[model samples]
Target: MDVAVAGGQTATTSHQLDPLQRGLLTVFRSLPRTAESVPGRPTPLVLDVGDVVVLVSGTDRGSPATRDAVLDLATDAGVVVLDDLPGRTPTGRVSLVLATHHTAATAAQHVAVRCRAPVLLPDGRCVTPGPLRLWVRPEPTLTLTRPDGRQDVVLHDLHLRDVADPDDEHPAVVDVFAHPSGSGLLLGMTDGGAGATVALSTGPRCVRVPAPTTATLDGVTRTIAPGTYRIDLAHPPLYRLHAESAARPETG
Candidate 1:
């Protein structure tokens, strides 16, 4: 797992922080660090003003069943996936981050000063217990293959392969993202002339993103050389985040 911090310089894995780390946390709004939030990977979940971390622990890491369920939840919620909660939240304090399971053990992951949980936080009552889920949500990932032939689990992905055109020249980059209703700029093809066409469809379909391209899947980004690319996926699913209507207790 890699650290995905947005702001602090010093990384404090222990809940007990040194005076310098505590001072830095106060000085900065957020800090970026390569925290292995879990024994595995990372994805984006949101926190709001007076909010902290959203912990995600999956029963199925890369199972098709899990992906489908998450997609469906996002579709029903009608909120778009985001890197963090800058504009998505009402207070908008840039306090949100998508940390993995057992956040109580990984307080240094998000490096936030506080967390928003239903019960009284072990730290103190910095955040009120209320219905924050109506606005805050988690951005789950859809597993996909990247250009360099690696397995990548990402939030919101798009790819176009097997386009039946040879005369077309490649575009500088591949563009892909979608809305909650299963529609958006659903494509990854050559920059052909006006006659070019593609059958954009929803997931459980296998597709490839041809080489020599770069893609930015919301918070995740990658690039591939002319021939160095490979992507393995259970096909495409909805490009959105999973949401819960009922608020549950979360670790900060």
Candidate 2:
């Protein structure tokens, strides 16, 4: 017997073959099945065109037809096409949209038709992932002094969100002093001859010294690691100091 196949793609043949034999043949014909392994769900890809890079999410990578359709839509809308994105898949969020060229005006129009994912423009605008702000503020500075003519002054500039303390006094400076014999920098207070508080940039994970006793700051000279640090002060008054250290200090 013979079977008729449509589209002129399948052969018209019938033989005494079992179901297992036919299945095996079908599997053998589809070797290195790249197309079959492709995901049915949408994928994200980054396309670079000219100086602009656009991220297209929910795209069909396996199907050439679908890819061409997306590319056509993008070109018509004047959106520059970058390359495929790197790393893990985008979990349905358009985190950022940076425009290096003047293609922002057409970004929305192009992205609207091709992607079900949120569209972000070059002007820090996005259709998905809500609003995001990348703005950052400057850090604060403070000075430290000792009665033995030992002093260390450093800037305390850092990310405001990391160092802001509402419970503690606003603009408060906690001076800390350490003797040459101590292994760590100890915290001190203003009246008790304790050193001022020095805010660290690398967060509390780095060096965190509590207010130290007057004996820590009295006779032995104090040494500070040179680096930019945030100084919390009680009043808005600015203070400066000049001191020598046995170990070279870090500068910001």
Q: Best-fitting candidate, measured by lDDT?
A: 1
lDDT of 1 by residue, 1-252 (tens): 122333322222234433322232222222222223554454333322333333232232322232233233334333222222321222233233332222222232222222222111112111222222212222222444433545443434544332222233653433334222234224344544444334444553233445445555434455644442333222332122121123456989
Please give the lDDT score at residue 180 for candidate 2. 16
| Off by more than 4 A, model 2 | 1-53, 59-67, 76-78, 84-252
Every model: Cα RMSD to truth: 17.7, 26.2
Worst 10 residues of 1 by lDDT: 118-127
Q: Assess every candidate by TM-score.
A: 0.29, 0.17
lDDT assessment of candidate 1: 0.31
